[model samples]
Target: MMKRARQDAMVENAAPQTSQENKKQKTCFYGSAFSESDPHGSIDWGSLPHHVILRIFQCLPLVDRARASSVCRRWNEVFHIPDLWRRFEFELNQPATSYLKSTHPDLIQQIIKRHADHLQYVSFKVDSSTESAEAACNILSQLVNCSIKTLGLISTAKPSFMNVSKAHFASALTVVFVNSKSLSSIKIDDTPVDDPSLKVLVANNSDTLKLLKMSSCPHVSPAGVLCVADQCHGLKELALNYYILSDELLLALSSEKHVDLEHLRIDVVSENPGQVEFHTIKKQSWDAFVKHSPKVNIVMYFFLYEDEFDAFFREETPVTHLYFGRAVSKAMLGRIGLNCPRLIELVVCANGLQPLDDELIQIAQRCKNLTAMGLGECEVTCRGFIEFVKVCGGRLTQLSIMEEVLIPDNDYSLDRLHLEVSKHLGRMWFPDMMPTWMQFDAKVTKTLQVKCGIYT
Candidate 1:
């Protein structure tokens, strides 16, 4: 009986030991479950050096960065790093488009709310819709404190972002102009940006601004542009419509204090076809402008009626790169040969069937520096072409003349003309030939035709 009592006591002691072992087993199981459930705790990616991780994140596109943020807690934290958000492009596309994917509004808001301070360079590109414009405005308005250095607003639509009311567009843009005091490059074409907004831009960014392109902003007058010219003497390049040009503005640009301008693009728009009276700059005025900035590139795009050519080249004009949108006349081309002494590039789309023999020869003789020429729907005899090539020589770096433009006269020999021009161009050309599929065929079609007694 005494041995049985001792045995029963031993059994009770062993039961407590068993309970302790079970508790240890439960603790081990819970630890492994926690490790599996908490992915960040299990993965070693978070242990990567912060800078290395940052570079990897930087290479990912803005859209992909948002997706990677949901991967784990550590990645979510990295997504918020300021460096990743410095240069952002807010591309807005319609709901169904193949060109680009539209940015989610919620994500845009998240960026503006959390990382707007990190933005330095920004661009907004939208398709043809008011909704997209309004979305852009919303983002711009939210950038009340953004100090961006470069800003570009582009519209891929027909009506363009300018379709938005002036008041609305200016209100949003003013927010940026008022805040971004360090802006250097600003491009706002076909927007409703006016003089008041321009004043704000100049007041804020005059010292830092280097390039400005505000073409098709009708509300901006000559005085408005002049204000910018006088205030922003550091501007290297400026593009605007012709109406914004005046003697005062040109004189301001020519001032010694103003840095020698590098590029000046003028878009000549004719809204009313019947209106014959258009603005004209004097010959001496251009001479003075060129004298101050000799190396300046003067680009002119003409969108005028055939009758409107009377005032354009009445006297020697200072146009370096000239493009004709209408069917130019021989007389106008003759005037160009005499007036455009500084012409370097010329593109003519259409002229009648009458061969431009004299005009081509005159241009070849006069425009010594002409390096590039493109002709379409025009005619030039083989003799005239050969003469043009002789005068211009191999220096014509860019020559785009259609096959139809070469007229066959008494001096016509396509093979001979091709040989001469090709030798100078250092390339092969069949001046009389047009491209078709049979040119590269492997079969000996000519031999076969001869064997069958067939002639082309």
Candidate 2:
């Protein structure tokens, strides 16, 4: 009788101890044990407000945010918030050479299945692999319910989209064009997007389309772009190749029904040096465009040889920003000074072995709006450069001249050239020296190689 009573007493004492241990374990916050002495020991992380948890998830990266969703049912609910999926970039890359981590296939499927309707801004960044491009297309085709507002397909290296089947690419692109009825911006450079795809885009998103950049798209003819301009009256920015830019297209854009164009970027690329002949745009057509959009910025990027510049700068051209990726001759610079009075910025990557003394002075005298200039591999005497700067006199906002471009003369030596130029410009300046490593890089020859698709 005595032993049975003692055993019952021990069992009763151990029951409450076990219950207290369970209570302490329940006080843990997200797997972290908290002591009773800590002030936040009694706090419950799962009880946090939905918006506060959402704000925390918004600052995390895509992968991290997805992993955090599995913490609890409440956190998973916050993960499904529509606002979190508004702007997202799908980094589609190959594993062999790419340093960037590719988006998980499972995550992409979840996004398409759950949050397709919430995506407003989306972009796909792919590498120079056909597999990656195909993956992007596969994902694009599955976005059947997406209401995307802005879309961009970017290639990190040489265009891989061109390597895919044109029909396949067009079919996938048409899916987005037809489905996303409210698209405002699109940048599909170096793709195989054809005329039919562009037409579908115009048909679906004519009123909402504001910016369209389709440079280096060979399949798209001049008529295709004109169709967009005729229908999409809200287009404010456009970028295309020079081959597709015709007088008729300019006229269409300058029509009263079209909105005032804000930016126009033309890439003049010559695959064959002297064999390719360029057609000229009439001054009357250019004048009409200026009348319609006076404040428009007309940017031209030239990747043509010296002989291929015959059709340009012949008559009065209203180019505001000009970039020459090849070795421009002194004669062409002189013509630019004479014909281009509205010039604001000029970048000459390479030039012939001619001292551009008179050409520089003539440009300063004529181009009153000139504010920025960059000379890379060109010859300009120290005295002539000083005289040019004196004429502009504090109006030059950015002047990037290479050290090798300035030749020492009797009037100005290397040491004294900057001092004199600084006095005229009302600020200190120095000649840009070529870095030793940059000399071996091909990018030094063409600054627009990546963005504008103008390679040397």
- TM-score of every candidate relative to the true structure: 0.81, 0.89
- Please list the C-alpha lDDT of all candidates, in the order they appear: 0.79, 0.88
Q: Which ten residues in a row have the lowest lDDT in candidate 1?
A: 447-456
Clashes of each: 0, 0
Name the TM-score of candidate 1.
0.81
Per-residue CA lDDT of model 2 for 1-456, tens digit only, reads: 999999999888874547678567656545444556664765566777788789999999888999999999999999999999999999999888588999999989899999988999999999999999999998899888989999999999976888889999999999999998999999999999999999999999998999999999999999999999999999999999999999999999999998999999999999888777799999999999989999998999898988898899899999988888788999999999999999988888888788999999999999999988888788999999999999988998788887989999998997899999899889998887777667613566544232223231
Candidate 1 residue-wise lDDT, 164-193, digit = tens: 888988999999888889888999888888
